[model samples]
Target chain A: MHRTNSLLTELKKNKMLFLMLIPAVLYFIIFSYLPMGGIIVAFKYFEFDKGIFGSPWVGFKNFAFFFQSGQAWLLTKNTILYNLAFIAAGMAVQVGVAILFSELKGRHIKKMMQSSLLLPYFISWVVVGSFVFGIFNYEFGSLNTLLKGWGMSPVDVYGNPSIWFFIIVGFYLWKLVGYGSIVYLAAIMGINPELYESADLDGANIFQKIRHITLPLLKTTIIIMILLQVGGILRGNFDMFYQLVGNNSLLFNQTDVIDTFVFRALNQQGLDLGMPAAVGLYQSAVGFIIIVSLNALIKKINPDYALF
Target chain B: MAKNKIRRIDMLIFTIIGYIVLGCISILCLIPFLLTVSGSFTDDSSLFEYGYRLIPQEFSLEAYKLIFQAPEVIAKAYGVTIVLVFTGTLLGLFFISMTSYVLHRKDFKYRNKFSFFFFFTTLFSGGLVPWYLVMIGLGMKNNYLALLLPHLFSVFHIIIMRTFFTSIPESIGESAKLDGAGDFTIFARLYLPMSIPALSTIGLFIALTYWNDWYPAMLFITNPDMMPLQYHLYKVFNSMQAAQIVAQKTGIPVAQMPAETFKMAMTVIVTGPVILVYPFIQKYFVKGMTVGAVKG
Candidate 1:
């Protein structure tokens, strides 16, 4: 009772702070938490009038149908593989660029490169899709144009499903390399120059210094980024994939990931609602578990680095 | 002598690797932009016959002329985008900063709970499908509100605002309280004035979100008149048939039209304003990202 009183007293003392937080608090309750109550829609038919709570409980029916459709394994495979490739490739390119940027001593070239690299980050995927279509269009695409100019037969890239993985990966790299490198570069910049000065005094060359000093310091940032990425490993880059592939059923075999698959499944048929809700629920749940576990592991390894 | 020899070698190797890496990064960004720029000016039949080229075989402005002739559609899109971006940025920055000011008050007992209220949303969202359903339930579908409201405020922005607020000297607030200034007055006069960097960063973020967003417009808007610039541009760019048909209907010469280059020109058009403001925005955003790197 006394403990409760002290807590109440403390709360009252900070009443203004509590007042300040009320709007955000109300926002989340209405938008975020209130909607969590509707996850029951994943299990229900979700009649608009009847709403989530009063809707008929359909049990595991939605999940069963989704699994039975045989898209589950394919989408899961595609999502995981694509994300893994993105993370792996993106990290390598970004880190390499960051390392080079930090090492390079020229002022004008560095400034120019920084500005130029960041330009792609500003472009929308809509424009990016147009760029892709322009380059890959069967009749008039740049790749084909170049090939024909060389007296070689132009490849029909759009019709070829096999080419999509490389094309998609290439497009993703083009859009994100500069943006991702900025973060790594920020991390590199934050590293104490005194450390480098000490290395210089110790007669260590630049390459040796980077190997011994810079890479080691970058490990924490890299690890944190990778772990954070692991949480969303199931969440594909929906915008990129959607824009790049569109509804081209041919490339669905190679390109369709869980998010896109769920979108199509919802929109294609009479709004099943339940199927996408179930998949979305599944994604959130897995994501939550992965993130929580990753946080826990981080806490165990290094408490300071743990996200929460 | 050994150290001097090693220094020269190190600089040589560093310069070589640096130039190569920088060159590749620049090329990666530059090539697509070049393709878009060149393709926009290239003749349509030529494009249809040969494909997009870095160099135009028969350069023409027919595509530009068609767009300029019927500029009403693009102009409306631009107007809508500008309004949405301005309104959304101001309102979002206000709410986020206000909310963060309260949360950062260490004396507030409910700060932790309220922080959790906001923070928990980030961990487990109802996901896109249900949220879409909820929006539909609320009858925001096809409404401009659908585009503006859902993303009016983000949890990420709130946290950054809170961090900035927490860095403020608490004595100012205590002194303000002593002066009988209301909490709102203190916030507006004292806190808001001091946190321009935080405000600018959050404001730019909100503005960018509004400017770049086609997701909400795509989901809800089907009316051609109501479509935002990015989404309108998206629809035209995606369907070659759509662009060709529009070109034909507008009485553009099929032979002279630079359909590909026109697309590039539109891209350059849409992205032009943001690029002009980018260097300033980028500096703040880079700073914000590092400070907000508190979260993964």
Candidate 2:
């Protein structure tokens, strides 16, 4: 009774704030929470005539189909491996560029280089796909035309699946290195200048300064960034995969992730809703566990970096 | 001294390597764009003969002319994109900022609870199938709302905006309250204006997301007339119809048309505004990234 009275008083006191929050509350409820409730579709035999709630419950059948199909392992392996590659390559390039940027002397050159590097980030992946096509297309592609000019046989990139892992990672870094570097650059900037000054007084070389001071200070930021990325390691960048590889089944073995698989199963495979939903639920549940456990780990290590 | 000489050499080597590395990466980043532009302007026969080059072998405006010949298609796409970007950015910025404002209030008892409420969505979701069903259930198919709604409220943006608001002195709000100001008026008259840097950063991020959105359009919009610029470009790349229409409108035989060059031109046209304005707005993006990194 006392708690109810206090809650009423608090509600009365902050009526406008509560009112202002209603739209966000409603938005989240509709977009996020509603779908969360809809995860039950994974366990059901969904019919078009009957809604998600009305669908007949078929326990574990959808999951059985997914696991039995052998796609579950492939998708999981591809997603984790590709994300690991992206994170490793991306961190190296981004950190390297950030260090170079901080060391470089000319302001104009730095600005120009940074701007040019960032250009690819602004363009859509579809444009990147077009660029890839322009370079790799068999007849009119630059690669084939150059090969033909050199009196060598033209190689078919799209026909080859093994090369796509490198291509995907290369493009991911190409688009994101500049953007990612800015974070480390900010961290580098935030480091105490007096440390550098004292090092200078000690006659420390630029490389030593970077090795001893800059890198050490950036450790926290890097750790936090890696942890953040690790949390979403299961989620594939659907835009990049879909645009670059598209409906080309030839490359699906090399490039397919959980997202594209779910997408194909939903749109292309013709109404096998339960299986896709089951895979999605699996992805979400694993991703949720990863994030929660990682957050706890981060909290134990450094409370400030913990997402929660 | 020998040590001084070694130090100078080390600095020299580092400087040279820095320039070389940064220069090469910049050129690699820029070469594709240059090739696209040059390819778009190259004559069809030359493109077929020599492929894309940094400089056009035979300069021609025919591809662009073909695009302008059917102006309505590109114009309508630009229209849809513009409307979506403007409406989505404004609404998204307002709601995001408002929510952040409430959460940033030091006195708000439920701030942590609300923050968690938004943040939990990022950790898990019902995945695309249910989200798609939810949109379909809401009758968002073929609706522009489908495009606008999904990119509207990002949890990341909310966190960034709240962090920005936290930088503001709380005494300002406290003083405003003493002067008979309601929370809404204080937020509107003071907080919104004070938070322009954060606002612009988030606004540009939201605007860019809306501008570059094609996934939502692909899922929801089936009508050709409803396509945004990026999706339209995707269609042009995939389908021959966009080129065929150009060929028909210009009275050129489809066999003789510059379909490849036309695709490149369409890409350039679609991507042109972003490249043009990127230099001016990128600092804000960098600022946003840094700000998020600091507190995130």
Residue B254 displacement (Å), model 2: 3.4
Docking category for candidate 1? medium
- What tens digits encode model 2's per-residue C-alpha lDDT throughout A123-237? 9999999998888888778778778889998889999999999999999999998999998898888888999989877888989999999998989888889998999999999
Per-residue lDDT tens digits for candidate 2, residues B1-296, read: 77678779889999999999999999999988988998899898887778877788899998898888779889999999999999999999999999999999878888888999999898889999999899999999899899999988999999888888888999999999999999999999999999998899889989999899899998989898899999999999998776676666678888877788989999999999999999899888887877777664
Considering just the first chain, candidate 1 attains a TM-score of: 0.90
Q: Distance from true position, residue B257, model 2, in Å?
A: 2.3
> Could you give me the TM-score of model 1 versus the true structure?
0.93
In DockQ, how does model 2 score against the reference complex?
Answer: 0.77
Off by over 4 Å in 1: A1-22, A46-55, B239-262, B294-296
lDDT of each structure? 0.80, 0.91
Clashing pairs in 2: none
Leading candidate by TM-score: 2
- Candidate of highest DockQ: 2
Q: Which digits, one per residue and each the tens of the lDDT, describe model 1 over residues B110-156?
A: 67777777888888987777777777877876798888887777988
After superposing candidate 2 on the true structure, give the runs of residues whose Cα lies further than 4 Å from its correct spot.
B244-253
